[model samples]
Each structure stands twice: as C-alpha cells, then as structure tokens.
Target: MALPTASLLAPGRVVPPAPLPAAEVARAAAPFGQSTMLPRGAYQDDQVLAWEREHLLDGWVCVGRSTEIAPKGMRAESIGRSGVLLVRDADGALRAFENACRHRGHELLPCGGSSQGTRAIVCPYHAWSYRHDGSMIGAPGFREVPGFDTSLYSLKPVRVEEWHGWVFVDTSGQAPDFGSHIGQLESVVERYDADALVTPVVHEYDVEANWKVIIENYQECYHCPSIHPELCRVSPPDSGDNIELEGNWIGGNMDLRTSAATMSLDGHTEGTVMARLDEVESRTVMYVAVMPNLLISLHPDYIMSHLLTPISPDRTRIRCSWAFPAEVVEREGFDPSYAVDFWDLTNRQDWAACEAVQRGMKTPSYEPGPLAPSEDGVYHFTQLMARAYQGQQA
Candidate 1:
C-alpha cells in the first residue's frame, strides 16, 4: 500500500507542485499496427497500480528456484507486493507464509533473520513466536487472556508449490496450480535439471527505470546488437524473435557458438557433456520474462534468474542469481568468475542503456513510436500491459 501524501505536509503550508496536481501521461506510446486500445499511462497509473496490487501482486508468482534453498533453507520476500516466508521444515518439507506474526502485525523476518535448526519464526515487536510450519508456538502473556485464541493466531500461510526446483507463491490465495499457470514452461524448465544445480553467486542492482522497461529490454534482441557488444558477439545478433507469447509471458532463444569451456562442475569435462557445446553448431540460450517481474535465463551451461521489484514509478531493483551444477558445489572451491563475469558485464551495459532511456522518456517532446512489423515482441508486450490493466482475461 502507498503511504499517504498528507503525512509529510506541513500543518498550514504546502510544498512545490502545489500550483499543479500531478498529471498522468503514458510514456513512449507505440502502435503495433493492430489496435490502439490502451494508453501508455496505464503502465504508470495509480489506479491501475492499485488494481494490480489487489489482483496480480496479491496472486502467486515465482520467488526463487528451489535450488537456492534445497539442502539448506533461505528467506524470500515479495516486498511491496507482500512479504512471503519460505522455509524447509524439520521433516524437510518446504513451507511458505505471509512472513508475519499474527500478534501485533510484526514482520516475522526483518533484516533476514536466521533460524537455528530448531528456532522458528518470532516477532521482534513482542517476542511472540511460531513453529516452522507457521503454527503459533507461543505468545507470552496472551495465552492466559480470556478472549485470546491461539487457534486463530497462527501466522498467515500462503500457497506455495515447487516446480523445477523453483519456489512460487500466490498472494490472492486464489491462483491456479503453479504448474498449470505456467503452461509448457514446466516441461521446458524441467529439461534444464534445475534441482541439481547450485548457486555460486547472487548479484543485485537497482536501476532507474520502471519495471516494464527492464521487462521489455529482456523480451527482445532488437537492442542487443546496439547496447550489448560482447553479448551480441557471443549470441547471434537479430536471431531473437518471439517464438511464444502466452497471456502475459514472452520467450525466445539466442544463438551462440560455445567454447571448449572444458570442465563441468564435477571436473568431468572429458565426457560427452564437455563435448556437447563444442560439437554443436551455434548453441542457443533461452530467456523468458514471465510477465510482471520474474525473468529467467536458461543457458547451455548455467542458469540465471532476474527478479524485478518496482521501487517507485520510475525505478526498479533487479536481483540476479547465477546457478550451476551441484557436483561443483560439493567440490567447494569453484569461483563464480567463469559465469558471473559474463552476466555482470552484460547487465551493467543494459542498466546504462535503460537509465538513459528513462531520462529520455521524461521529456515532453517524446511520443509513443511506431513498431516495425519485425518488432512484434515489443508490440506484444505493450499489448499485454494494456490488456492486463483494461481487459480482464477471465
């Protein structure tokens, strides 16, 4: 929920912009040669934002690939969307909840609180705590109260399902099964063998662009040739075309010639695995922006996850994780330099480009440009934005 504007106002005075109320203008409108049914402002509207917060943001979305929390558990949150807590229980079953204490509305995990093998969630505000399963364990001074009911005070639990070692949570408490909602992505992701992978590095940055800008950037390769020189050199330029667009999702493949890159995580680079990329002509990398904010990259040898969290109307935080094979993890000395360096440089280039674009769009002279027939993926993405805001798919 948005904080109130009046809270910062002086008792009897006003600040700048008092002469004019904030105006709503959709930025960078583009015609797809299909229909002009939606406004660009829909991407930035407070009303539409509110609607999304109530509907989609409240609904389940992918959080992290299960590989991040497999042998040991980790913490996750949706931030403004909502706070979600996912932990592997004693029996090792994964559980997700609202990340809160039922009493006094305290956040269960602040500053990423850690749990011993036994200590579960506890409220920092009152010291009340719960079991790993989100069941209320103890709330001192409240149990003896005549009207207090522990049965109704368990921390709120969210719907969670692990698919392809990825953790997904729906906030509306009313989303279709995680696998079904993602369609064929389930099978496609499974082929990657994600569950066996181990994370080597987690890189995150905040970019000065709307969440949509980052999503659109990842959705197409039109800009790849110009913005990312090394990436374009590694992956064939102009090779990315929309292969699938389902509802709010977009996916495509980038063609790249692989190097000997000898050595799998297991140090068994001598086998067919090490030779697969070398033997192949133009290995391909797959990227999908699962609408809203979750963007995932499945490469020939490793996987990267980009999770976008909107900070404001024109800024977003991008969290990325580099994951690889587990055998290499057990080996314990593999440096992330091999895979991490490539993505870090590529993402930096993208951030620089997007920050400039955001500044350009702020000008009054800018207009929604026309989409060439070849740029259908960008067109489709904007179309979904319009549909999501104005058209109810159901």
Candidate 2:
C-alpha cells in the first residue's frame, strides 16, 4: 500500500520552549578550552527534558537493527510521545505506522513489544485490523454506520529509514531527509559493510543517568585509565585525533596497543579482520556518536553499538549489541564472549560512572565544570546541545 503524506497525519504541535538561564547558555557557548559542561538543571530538570523531547529528539532516532524484525514480523517503539510500529510485510518490505488502532485509538502493540509472523495488526479493543502495509482491512460493526468507509481510516504512516543494518524513524515527519541527516558518515562507514554483519550478543541496561550524560561519557576517554582499566589496556587513552567532519555526528579513533589484537578480555581475537579496513583502521578503533541516540564503535574484527532511549530526565535505557562478520560467526566453535564479556565489564563500569554523575547533579552545590583539554568531543557535543536549547541549529 502507498503511504499517506505526513500532512494527512497531523504534524506534532510545536510548543514554545522556555528560555534557558542566561548563565547556562553562556557556559555552553564558551570556547572549547574554556567551556564547561551544561548546568545541573539541564540534566536534572523536567522542563529541560520536555524541551529536549520536543526539539533535540525530534529527528532521525535509531530504534534498533533492521535484522530484529523479520518478514511478517512487527516491533513496537516509543519515539518521544508517539508509539510507532515497525512491520515487515510478507514481501519483505519494511514499513512503519502509528501504533494506535483507527478506532478508539487503542495501541496495536505496546511499546517495546514484538510479535512474529504477524499476518494482521488486530487491535485488542475492537478487533479493527490493518494489513502489514498499514492499509485498513477490516473494521467490525463499522460498516453499518451511515458513511463508514474502511479506505478512509487506514492506519497513519510514520517515516522509517534503514541505513546499512540500523533502523531509524522520524516520528515528527518534519526533520530533514534521512540522507541529509546521515551525511558524510556514510562514506566513512561504507567500508565496514555493516549490512552484512550479524549481531550475536545483545545487552540491555537500565541506567539511572540522563541520556546526555551517557553520550558525553561515550564521547571521551579521559576517564578510561581511571574507570575502564581493561579498555585502557587494550587501547591507548591518549592516542587519537578528533575528526572535524561534515555530518550530524562527532567522534575519532583510538589506536589499539601493539600487543593487543582486539578488544577482548585477553586482548586477542579468533575472528578474522573485516575485509575492507585499511591499515590505519585495522590498528585503531573508531568511536562515533550519532547525534541524539546512537553510538557506533568500529573495530578491526567487529562493530559495537549502543542505542539510547531516554526514559525520563534522569533515566535512560541502553541497548548494546556486538556485530561480527557472518563468516566469523559461522566458524566452527565460534564464540562471541571474547568481545561480549570484555564490553559487558566495560559497559557496567561506564554505567556506574554515569549514575554517579546523575546523583551529583542533584547536589545543591553542583555547578557546571570545565572541560579538560582531552575532552574535545565532549565540548563539541555540549555546544550542539547548547544551541538546541536556544532554538538554534549547530
């Protein structure tokens, strides 16, 4: 079925945002070497989070890998205040729709729920059904109405785009085109051939920290020597350069120690190196934080991703996954624990630190602090967020 225009499904109402405190804006706008972190209220206040949900989180937000939903399968996601349903038709085409049923607006699938072999999306409230492509198929007891027409009540469509293997959705339907949003990052990751990779391990964490806190943590490694001993042992904490690229993302690469082969507990890997990586890529790990919600780490042997879902002002849900080449996963006695266990430990340590920051944000004496010289990525992200708070684009 052809999708309906975004206008058909009313655009999200744009509410005027409360202005940020002058001091906060000034702090965020400071030069990198002189800049400080965003104010505590930015991380701890409900109104600040509401502004973010309306502004920063409106664009292309990553939900998960496209591989998670199979043909004739459906997965539900919560994007800002809207619930979206991702469906894979029998023909293998991926589609998305507002999760609500046409009648009474009951949710077709609860957020975070998934169903396999879903031939029809049947609403539990009244059994109204929709095809995989979101066209209305049946509406019980509605045909008797004076002018009831099934064609006029098809489920509303939401914009969904799949880049490589990752699935992104635009709930607001008002953001820039997906290609524009992804920008030059495409050329950078093209060599990875991520679409051909398979994720063998997935970990979920309920972190008691603001979403930005977790992202800021991912963007810097100044704390690696202190918090992530294992990670620091495998990759040098000070050996990397931040790339000034043309994309809606920020990141750089950290060289792996010569003695280490990959990011594993033993600093070695049985897996084969990815096919297209150059010599530099083979020796360094690239960490890219896609604006707002996704973190991508590219290693010689595999790829790791973190998808962030902001639960509230001070809570975020993180889904972490590790992907390896299909051939590597199919090898005899193939085991992912080498990569998984290493990251699981590293991830928990990072989460603990983030939680500490969240708690610290509540302290009455807490205030924005200076960015270290090594925290260039953090400074860039902070500036972008500050512009967002002031209703300006970076």
lDDT of 2 by residue, 249-353 (tens): 888899999999999877999797899999998999999988879999999999999999999988999999999999999999999999999999999999999
TM-scores for all candidates: the values are 0.81, 0.95
Tens digits of per-residue lDDT, candidate 1, 249-363, equal 5677766634423212222121123122332312566787775668888766677889887767567888799776666555646666656777788889888887877777767
Pairing residues by index, what is the TM-score of model 1? 0.81
| Worst lDDT 10-window in candidate 2 | 1-10
Worst 10 residues of 1 by lDDT: 1-10
lDDT of 2 at 108: 96
Which segments of model 2 are wrong by more than 4 Å? 1-19
lDDT of each: 0.61, 0.85
